[model samples]
Target: MLRVGVVGVGNMGRHHARIYSELSKEGEVEFVGVADANLERAKEVASQFKTKAFGDYRELIGRVDAVSIAVPTSLHKQVALEFIENGVSVLVEKPIAESIESAQEIIRAAKKNNVTLMVGHVERFNPGVLKLKEILDENLIGKVVTLTAKRVGPLPPQIKDVGVIIDLAVHDIDVMSFLLERNVRKVYARAGSAKNPLELEDYAIIMLDFENATGVVETNWLTPHKVRTLSVVGTEGIAELNYITQKLILYNHEWVKEAKVQFKEPLRNELEHFVECVKKEEKPLVNGEEGLHALMVAIKALESANKDEAIDVEFT
Candidate 1:
């Protein structure tokens, strides 16, 4: 069995620890422990999971075979590198890292050590998104011309390291690319801050130009209620997906069809996939390169907003 541990049991990481604990109890992986900078918080989560706790994440280095690192975006490279250098596979949360340089650094170290590096782009594991992929692959919608997503809600207290583009839009940016199977050629974005205490942008509209299609994402934190949805318009039909409900609808010139979808926790699916990949000695669905590509597109989107012009994605 794979010995797994988690670092940073905060908003996102707590769930990782919980799921790992469940998987361990279910005879999948052995959940070694959890770590956090806050000793008290680490103890609390470890108590909840019935596992050991580490005040310092480095303590988990040699004990576990793989780790799920849910630290802040800025600390991703550091925490992940620690495990990688120790011959432990790591699954770091989304955006990979704060900048292109750090992301590349993590990727390089993973390659050098021959470690399995995974990024927690967990939305791709959503049942609704999986169903949408099936519909697209089956050509239920013809050539996709435009794909738009709306992901808006009040800002989580846990988000302090990044703005809406990096914090929120990256999900859709990665999803759009995954669905369209194309790389962003150019990116343009408009963003501003209203409610964020740190003055980070709370709302953004990003436009991504792919080789044959266009992708748009509306993300914000000022909304009173959450709304997570995606719309795909193609030559022959249009599709809509409700992320929260895991519902999908397709509309063509002939009829409107509601497709049945299995609802599962995205985080559990993501962690399960990570566990299986490690067990089978295989690559994760969202590997380091895919994570880096999404990060590059996100950086370009931010740059596009700052310069008020579309930026070409040549950095990737």
Candidate 2:
């Protein structure tokens, strides 16, 4: 069994610890321990998962064969490098790092050490999204023309370091790239701070121009009710997905077809994939470069908004 641990037992980190513990029951992984800056919180999560706890994340380095880095955005590169440089595979949470340079450093370090680095772009594993991809591949949507995603909800208490673009828009940007299999060619965005007490932009409308198709993502924190949805419009039809409900629907001139998808928690699938990648020495579904591309797109969007102009996209 592969020995595993989790660092950062905050809202997202606890879920990672819980999933690792559950993966242990199948005999493929062992939940070694969990660590957090907050010792009491770490102990609390460790107890719930029936494992040991460490106050400092560094303590998990030598003991764990693999680790999940769920710390805040600013801490991603720092925490991830600690485990990766020690020859531990890591599943770092989304957006990889706050800046492109930090992301490049982490990727380079992982390559230097030959360590597996997976990003937690969990939406890629959602049942509905999986179905949507299958449908697109089967030409149900014909040639794609436009893709749009809206992910809005009340401001989450857990997000402090980054605004909605980095926190929420990146998810759809990554999803659009994954679905289209093309890098973004141009980016334009307009954002403003509405209800955010931190004076960071809490709402944004980002437009990405791919080689052939156009993509748009609208995200905000002012919505009273949570919304997570995506749609793809193509030559023949349109596909709609309700992310939370795992529901997909296709609309054509002739009729509308609602897909029947088998539901599985996206986080569970993501962690399982991370474990499989480590054990089999395989590349992840969302590798380091993919993560970096998403971060780059988001950063470009912010820059576009700041300059009040479209930014040409290029990933080196």
Candidate 3:
């Protein structure tokens, strides 16, 4: 059995803890412990799962074979590097880190330690997205010409670590990159603090140019209602996905009509994959390199926004 530990117990962190606990009872994984900077929260979570709790993650690293780092974006490198140094595999929450330099350091550390390094780009595991990707890969949508995604929600309390681009739009950016299977050639973006008072941008719009397609992503933390939706257009058909509703609508010439499908919960599947990866010692579907690429794209978008010019993306 592979022992697993989760660091952080906030909104998303708490969800990770709960999922891990349930997966353990289902015999998919072994929950070892949970850690958080807030000792009380860690203790509370540990009590719920009947596992050990620690205020510092170091205490749990040696006891577990792998860890899920759900800490803040600014601390990703520090916390993940510690676990990697101790030869513990890690599944870190998305965006990797605030800078490419830090992301590369963590990637190098994971490679040097010969440990599995995964990024928590949970959307890719969504059933609706998975099905949609299958259709796109099969050429149901025929060569995608353009795509757009809008993710807007009310602003949460400030974390002051990263801007909205990295915090939110990175999800769509990564998803688009995965679906298109091509590097973004140029990017343009504009953003600022619209609702909350912080150094990070609270609202933003990014435009991307690809070799065969173009894409746009508008992310804001100042919307009245939570909205997460994406639309992909191609020469033959179109696909629309409502992430909040877990519904996918496709219009294809083969069907001569539109077809709709509903998706079950995606978080459960994402956690299940993590459990399987830990037990089987397999690389994750979304690895650290993918997360780094997303970060690189976001950084260039921000640079474009600041300079009021289009920025080019450099890939390795």
Candidate 4:
């Protein structure tokens, strides 16, 4: 059995621990333990999962074959490097790192240690998204011409380190890239901090130009009700995905078809995939390079918003 632990048992991290603990009963994985800077929070979550708790993540370095890092964006690099340096595989939460430099550093460390590195772009595992990809791959949409996503909800109490672009819009940015299978050529964005107490943009519109398609992402923390949706317009028809409900619909001039999808908890799927990768020594779907590319686009959108101009996206 592959041994695993979770670092930072906060909102998302606690769910990670729960899933690992549940999976452990099947004998496929061993839920080792959890670590958090907040000792009480760590202890509480470890108790729920029936595992030990550590005050410092360093305590888990040599004990597990892999770990899921769900600390804040700022501490991602520091925590990820420690585990990677100890030859442990890691699955870090989205945005990879606060900046591209730190993301590169983590990627370099993972490579040097020869460990499996995965990024938790959980949306990729959503049933709707997976079905949408299948339909697109089969040319049901007939060459995507444009894509648009709207993800808006009230401010999350746990988010204090980043703005809407990084925390919210980055999801769509990565999804758009995944669907189109191309890098963003340019980004034009506008953002504001209306109603948000923090000095971060709570509302933003980002436009992305890909080699073959145009995309728009609308994200905000001002909506009273949560909304997570994506629409694709192609030469033949339009496809819509409701992320929350995991529903997909395809529309054409002659007919309308609703896709049938088997929904699974995205987090469980993601973590299971991470374990399979570790056991078989395979590359994860959302690898470090993919995470870095998404981060680059999000950073460029932020720059565009700050400068009030369109910015070119460069990949190194």
Candidate 5:
């Protein structure tokens, strides 16, 4: 059985632990344990999962074959490097790291250790997104013209390290790149703090220009109700996706169609794919390089917001 553990049993981390625990009962994998900086929190989660808990994440380095690191953005590199150097595969939460440099370091460490490294761009596993990808591949939308996404909600108390661009807009940025199959050529953005002001911005509107398509991402922490949706307009028709409900709708001159999709918990699908990759020694759908590119675009968006001008995106 594939042995697995999770570090940082916070909001998202706890879900990872729960999924692994359920998968363990099926005999396909073993839920080794969990670790968190907050010892009490770790103990509480471990109790729920009926597994061991550790105060230091490093304790699981040698014991588990794979680990899911859900710590804050700042600690991503530090924690990922430790486990990678110990030859443990890792599935790290989104945005990879705070900066491109740190992301590159994590990628290099995983490569040097020859371990599987996957980023938790969980939206990629959303049933609606999966179906949308297939529809695009079929050219149902014809040549894409524009993609727009809005991800807005009240400020999450747990978020403190990064702004809307990195924490929220990155999802749309990654999704846009995935659908368009091209790197961002330029980024123009405007961001500021209105409610729940911290060191980072809490509101942002980003416009991305690609080779043949354009994307707009609107994210904020001030909206009272949560909204997660995206729309794609192409030559043939327009398609809408609701991230929360996993719903897809198509609109054309002749007809309006609702695409049928089998809904599954995105986190479950993500964790399952990570485990499969570890077992088969295969590359994940969202690999280290893709993660880094997303980070680069996010960083550029921040720069564009600060400079009040469009910035050219340079990918390595």
Candidate 6:
């Protein structure tokens, strides 16, 4: 069984802990231990799950085969590199690292260690997205012509680690790249801080151009309502995905009306897939390269916003 340790017990980290605990209970993996800077919080989570707790993550590296890192963006490189250097597989929460250079270092370390390095771009596992991908693959959409996404919600101040672009909009950018399966030619964005004092943006609008079409994303933490919506316009039909409800809708002239479908919880599905990958030693759908590509586009968007000019994503 794969021995798993989770570092960080914050909001998203807590979910990772619970999922790891459940995986262990299901006999798919072993719950090695958990670490958090907040000793009390770590102890509490450990006690709840009947696992050991560590104040320092380094202490658990030798004991676990793999680790799920849910720490802040700033600490992603430090934490991931530590475990990766010791030949431990890692599932790091998304945006890979705070910058492209750091992300490259983490990727390099994992490559040198020959350990699995996956990013937690959980939306890639969403059933709705999977079904949409199926339709696209079948040419049911008749070649996607344009794409747009709106990921907005009331401020979750606890997520001050990264800006809305990295924290929220990166999902759509990643999804757009997956859906189109092409290299983006150019990106333009505008963003500003809403409340936080840091340079991190709370509201942003991004645009990406591909060979055949364009994609747009509006992400913000200032919206009054929670909305995770994506609308894809293809030559044949338009598809809408409501991420919050796991519902999908397709509109076409041939249908006479729009068709709608609902799916189960994506988070559970995502975790199940992760467990399967670990058990099978298989490459995950959203691997480090995919995550890095998304980050590259996001960083360009940030640069575009800062310079007030369209920036081209330079692929390495």
Model 3 TM-score is: 0.95
Clashes of each: 0, 0, 0, 0, 0, 0
How far is 8's C-alpha from truth in model 2 (Å)? 0.5
Angstrom error of the Cα, residue 63, model 4: value is: 0.7
lDDT per residue for candidate 1 within 1-316, as digits (tens), equals 8999999999999999999999989999999999999999999999999999999999998899999999999999888888999999999999899999999999999999998999999999999999999999999889999999999999899999899889888899889989988788899999889989999999999999999899999999999899999999999999999999999999999999999998999999999999888888898889988898899988888888889999999745
- Write one digit per residue (lDDT tens) for candidate 5, span 1-316: 8999999999999999999999999887899999999999999999999899999998897789999999999999999999999999999999899999999999999999999999999998898999999999999978899999999999989988998889989899999999989999999999998876576798999999999999999999989999999999999999999999999999989999999999999999999999999999999999999999888999999999999999999996
- Backbone clashes in model 1: 0
In order of appearance, the predictions have TM-scores of 0.98, 0.99, 0.95, 0.99, 0.99, 0.95
Query: What does candidate 5 score on TM?
Result: 0.99
Per-model lDDT: 0.92, 0.94, 0.86, 0.94, 0.94, 0.87
Off by over 4 Å in 3: 252-262
Which structure is stronger by lDDT: 3 or 5?
5
RMSD of 5: 0.7
**Could you tell me which residue pairs clash in candidate 6?**
none
Query: Which scores better on TM-score, 1 or 3?
Result: 1
| Model 3, span 1-316: residue lDDT tens | 7788899877778788888888789876788989999999999988987888899888997799888899999899999999999999898888888799999999999899998888888888877777778889999888999999999998767366787899889899888988988878899999888666766788999999988899999999889889999999999999998877777888876664344545666777777787777667788888888999889999999999899999999988
TM-score of 2: 0.99
Off by over 4 Å in 4: none
Per-residue CA lDDT of candidate 4, range 95-139, in tens?
A: 899999999999999999999999999998898999999999999
Candidate 6 lDDT, 20-135, residue by residue in tens: 88888999889999999998999999999889999999989889988889999999999999999998889889989989999999989988888888898888878888888887
Q: For model 3, how many clashes?
A: 0
Pairs clashing within candidate 1? none
Candidate 6 ranges with C-alpha deviation above 4 Å: 256-262
